[model samples]
Target: MRIVPSEISSRTRSAAERSVFAALKAIPDKESVALHSVHLPAHRYKRVGEIDFVVITPELILFIEVKGGGIAFRDGKWHYGRGDGRTETRTEGPFEQASSGMHELEREFRQAVDGLRGRDAVGGYLVVTPDVDLPPMTTYEPEHYLGSTAYAGGRGLEAAIRRAANHWRGKGKNRSALPTISAQLRGDIVKAIRPEFDLVPSLHARITDLEATFERLTTEQLEKLDELEDNPRLIWTGGAGTGKTFLAAEAARRSSARGTVLFTCASHTLAAHVAGVLSADSIVVLPFDRLDEVRGRRFDHLIVDEAQDLMGFGHLEKLEELVHGGLDGGHWIFMLDRNNQVLAPAGYDPEAWKYLRDIGAMNASLRRNCRNTKQIVKQVQRYTGADLGIPMAGQGEQVVFAKVTGREDEAAQLDRHLDRLLDDGVAARDVTLVSSSGDWDNTSARLTRRFSRIDRYADTIGAGKQRNRITWASVVDFKGLENQVVCLIDLDAEDLRGRLDAVYVAWTRARAHLWIAVLPGVNHALRELGVAALAREGAAE
Candidate 1:
């Protein structure tokens, strides 16, 4: 059997529910899939119900309601004891809860999926009490309930479920026999029941998973590194999320094995980030402006990340002087994003790029995006006109767009988003708050007053402060760095449109999720660019 979540969530509090979830995994049927804690929206008299476990097999779909601790019924009421030595009363018992949730699930399934209302789908409900061996109740069928005695190393639980399924299979008469639920229909039912809930893991889990996968050099990046074997001087160009900075740092790390390597980038923040990652004693990571420290000194090799920002004749000349053999004879590698050249003060210089090529530097274009997810790449392309390669990451959370009326509204919306993210188990450090307002005064006042825990990314890196706190950053300083979650706030249409390159860089800074708070004008501009505007605030694709 396959579990929808693959692992039981840490948030699940009920011990009995956890036991049932584990027992469901013991089902011998290899094709079965069990979804735990399927939440159903409130409807009519029901105040939002949760089905403990929904087991979908090739033959039937079964909903299980579990009662833990001590359970008893008297005076038309049910009492459940807690591990904390407390008792809670409920008017409806486990059997009623199971039946109500099962019917509600069926109704929701029919409404969500097309052509499924008329199809005879086999579904039943069962009540499980893992800690109590309840006597047979006259109100419900004996096969529909499982006591503690029935949990014989999970095999007895499996037997009870099979018996309940058979009961439903036998209930149908000759004229209207229960139809055999095909595997395709069962899969469709599973999707219709809990599509997003079953697929999207907690934000904390996503960050850990994505960061683990991102720590290594991708196959394409390794292949690009191989090019350095023959050509010491190489120019690697790509759009955002294409792993340009990663390749640059890795190149520096490899070259450090041979000789002294000077790895540098435009942003001081980015330089600090790369410095922490590559700790080779032979490698020196520094910002471009700090090159004066080694003005008269020479390095065996030069590796520049975010090289697009320093593609000026003067900057290239300085770099040439710093290398042991100068530009033409020196061994060096330049990694840059051509699409983000506008982010630089002087912008990219065509003559300087030509200068590198004229000196026998091999150019390699990275087209596989190793950072952002497919949904984020789609959003970036639609708004910024930046094709960040084919996204090779997971199908992450959808890009969210929140329409705000003013600065106050933006602040309020961001607060709401932050609360939700915190609830989803995302750490404060995993989120970076990006201000899109051109003027600092236009956006900084309310944010600073509202979020006291937020520290500037540059300051955090410089001061060596604890990173367990949220960080704020300007679009330019956050150019080569990425977080699991990013919130782009205070977007002004005119300001954003003027710095499309900055917008490109800011939006791509999120590896898994991107949440944008857009003003009316900015929202309209995105719509004009064929980007779908959010129908409502906080709506995601």
Candidate 2:
């Protein structure tokens, strides 16, 4: 129930004020009974300063002065810093100014407002921008004309606003003379503010059971998939976490309805993930090593996911040979990200992944990543110096780089970390712990033993269904897969150098949070690789 709409527009408000306003909109009680951006007394408004937000509730009306940027009270006066580190301009009195503004509002409303005809109470506060260090103050006050005392910034302001709303809702109100118009209040405010309010309260994209959009394709991805149907032969490429395997599954599901669809990849783990999601009888998910078994069979469409991985083991001539002899429509699609070509015992060089372009196949590249938050993508980009393009940003934790004592501590740290992520509402299935090399017992077997106790993804299909498990995967096993929270553990300078592309692939696996774990006395090279030591974590084995 919006009584007075916020009149602050981009033209009227500075960027900082716009930020504050956006934050206010994200508040749960934003649309609930409020008067905003008001300078009352009908027309003599210059005498009274603007009240940024006034939450009108049954118990109390809260008058809030919203300011963005660094607000610190130091050296006896309140100073408003522009957040540029330097340039803290002196602002006279935000608290005193809000107090006086509320006084004028109450005095004028004594007669102007029919609801508050007699004695009534109000509250005032100064809501500053996030990360602003507000000096200590009273949580509540009663001596002033209006109750003006609470000082808040960021999420604290949301709590203050909610406390006022819940306080009013609990007491219940006499709405007979309320300021809210019956039919159009919410609509009017939504229309007025939706354009200007364009931010989440927090910056990261969250991953949870309810929010599975981390794997869903953007409109751009869907358009590319739709466009691929027209072309007989196509090569689709994208960075890791850009939904290559998901697109391949989509292709298999769609093509299976008409004719046979053969879906193949480099890893059996990814093949199994694809198999679980695609139920079409006409689709067969397999590895590239089994190409000879179905040598003479004709498939209407041959969809290759993780093309670099598949092409890593096989030759271009063999791929061409399979395509030439086995297809109903002679149509094939190769979906891969070249940067994801991690080295194996016998692996193709980066040059081998480019053979498709020589064949004059229609090509399309997707840059807008469908997985990983903007922050996670930035970290991966900083490390690899690759053009992965900006992500479709979502809410999640910042990337963490930590050094531990050894394997035992790494195990303990991951155990605690997994618990914290689950408590934060990330699905257990959405959290994955990965290692660069599977051969090292300290790195792989140590963590794998502990992970074996948890409910996790099984390597075999016949193994009974498992849910709510913290998944463990080799960095290679995780190709074309993404998780909400991923810990790239047991990686040091040696591991990172041994598989530089693996680091790029592993880092991009995080849809929300990326935590890189290393051992003590082994982080100097990793630091050079752009993964700085955040804090000591693991213990000795």
Candidate 3:
């Protein structure tokens, strides 16, 4: 049937609808088939369904239900919806509704045909949705009819009609004439319609899928890391143990071939760690303060490892100048922790948080903690608001809590615990000691001198100062850093109030194991925020 385009409204049908309508108009017909968008008779008992397109033919009638949403098949059902401000409600399954509509159309067409020619005729149901990558249909059972893309092409409708006519012709004992009738239908429709279906592989789609797969890969590798092509800017954020450092190293290694890649960290320790992983001649790992001096030199990319500590707009502006000014046409990779900005400068406006929303950023959350058990991660999440995204499967280590009378006693208790853990085969290198107060140098010094482990300062831990031994560091210095085991000491301070963010940073630093030493007056603003006791209790099995 000749499908007319003028009958349908351009306003009502979406972009996809117009495309489908244009395709349908190319089909030739024995008789003119008019397409219409008519409101069905209202049902007081049930909600009336709005038919997207209706085709009235000489011998048969067809009703089409269109869904423009990208169709997805799941759990033995098809699902599709659009973002039209209305919450989509799946009333009946698409297959069931299509079948029912087909049956109704057949009955209606029989009546219409009988009134005109005194004979029952054939009818069909069509469910049309464009731009859908539908799965191959294996069955055409009574309740599971799937429309193919091939049917929507030049000879699609005619081919469908021929199939229907063949079945009817068999029932009428005129099976020999079925072939002739099908040929006539095809000859009439196939020539007039111009089929313009393009089937080329989309490069953009392939690239997107590849990027998703890269993000989900489990193995540690330096290959297949994509550097931004134009206006390259990069931001990487992950909780502790998410391999942000390793990913940064990989980025450095891949981009080093293009030009000089400067690896800078907010602290020296992180820079040192990254420096150890890179070729000394290719990368210049430095602290954030030294960035200004290196501005005259040209670099292709800047990889910032401990970006969480690069707080305040001033620091960001300086980095931006170094990037957009010095390395005018370069890329950047920033590794950040949301809760890691503990030492916000005096009068730091909260509005500066908006700087975190800049473009060229990727969020790669490390779901599995290679260090801590699921129970420990959960407990830590409860306290520090770190969503580990891990479901508990079984029992794990219990989180232990002891309230000390003072800071000294707390430090001693922490030392005793460390001694016991070391005796239990927990290497000092596997553990990190964190605290809010930087004055814990005395405690850290005692631990360091006794155990021969270095005290890690977050600012000095990044590059050129890589210490393989266990270390003590303040939460601020260890913001974007993580370890297998962590012992938080001297965190229970009254003066260091409004530092729940610091507490969160310290708590998340431990990947596999965590130990918190709380002083007697440790019930500070952080504990009030449901972070301290909650995270500790939650982490404990």
Highest TM-score scorer: 1
TM-score of each: 0.58, 0.55, 0.50
Taking the tens digit of each residue's C-alpha lDDT, what string does model 3 give over 1-541?
Answer: 4443232331243655555565556566645443433221221111113344445554334555556666666666655666474434464655457557556544443444323234333445555555453554653332122254654533354555445444434555555532321333322321221110101111111211211111222322111132233236666565555556666765675466456778887766556555555653667778787787787675667877766666567776676665533323347777665434323334343455455444444434444444356766666566555554443223556666666677567756776777888899976666777766756545534543354555455533443343445677877667656666778776656634755567556776765667777665665544555655555556764
Model 3, residue 363: distance off in Å is 6.7
Q: In model 1, which runs have C-alpha deviations exceeding 4 angstroms? A: 1-214, 341-346, 438-450, 528-541
Whichever of 2 and 3 has more TM-score, that candidate is 2
Candidate 1 to native Cα RMSD, angstroms: 15.8
Task: State residue 175's C-alpha deviation in candidate 2, in Å.
Answer: 50
Q: In model 1, which residue pairs have backbone atoms overlapping below 3 Å?
A: none
Residue-wise C-alpha lDDT for candidate 1, range 125-228, written one tens digit per residue: 88888888887777688878988887754568878878887887667544246677677777777666544343222222222232322143455664576576
Candidates sorted on lDDT, descending? 1, 2, 3
lDDT of 1: 0.75
Model 2 stretches astray by more than 4 angstroms: 1-216, 312-314, 321-329, 340-346, 349-354, 439-452, 455-464, 531-541
Identify the runs in model 3 with alpha carbons over 4 angstroms from their true place: 1-224, 227-231, 311-313, 324-329, 340-372, 388-396, 444-470, 523-527, 531-541
Model 2 alpha-carbon miss at residue 330, Å = 1.9
* Residue 105 alpha-carbon offset, candidate 1, angstroms: 47
